[model samples]
Target: MESKKKIMSEKLPITEVNPINSRYYDYAHFTYPWHFHSQYEIIWVKESTGLCFAGDCIERFGPGTLIL
Candidate 1:
């Protein structure tokens, strides 16, 4: 129930000077909680293995996985 009530609204660091905001994350594990953003998100897994949750859809993802 916390995930349903505590959905975070993320404000991406995008500016007029830089339209697109890109970042590379190399972490031991995913620490971010359930969240949503106004802007579209594209996640590319270069090397990793985990589950991806989008709405009610849940699936396993591995290296070279691209989620749009």
Candidate 2:
């Protein structure tokens, strides 16, 4: 059997007036698949606990956890 890996390319909703894209999510769990973006990204978790996977690194994150 052949295994296939897929990653999604995400485009940020940025504009001239607002060059930065920010969001606040309150969900039971993350539903997005593996993805990548051209622009720099930052994730700040205000509340929740989960495992964060970046590249080949995996770490546990919770409230006040910031990733850049």
* Model 1 alpha-carbon drift over 4 Å, by segment: 1-5, 15-17
Candidate models: Cα lDDT each: 0.86, 0.86
**Candidate 2 deviant stretches above 4 angstroms:** 1-5, 15-17
The weakest ten consecutive residues by lDDT in model 2 span 22-31
Q: Write the per-residue lDDT of candidate 2 for residues 30-62, one digit (tens) a residue.
A: 877899877877888888899999767899999
lDDT of 1 by residue, 1-68 (tens): 35445889999988888779988888888887889987878989888898999767899999999987
RMSD of each: 2.7, 2.1
lDDT of 2 at 35: 92
TM-score for each model: 0.77, 0.74
Best by TM-score: 1
The candidate 1 region of ten consecutive residues with least summed lDDT is 1-10
Model 1 compared with the native: what TM-score?
Answer: 0.77
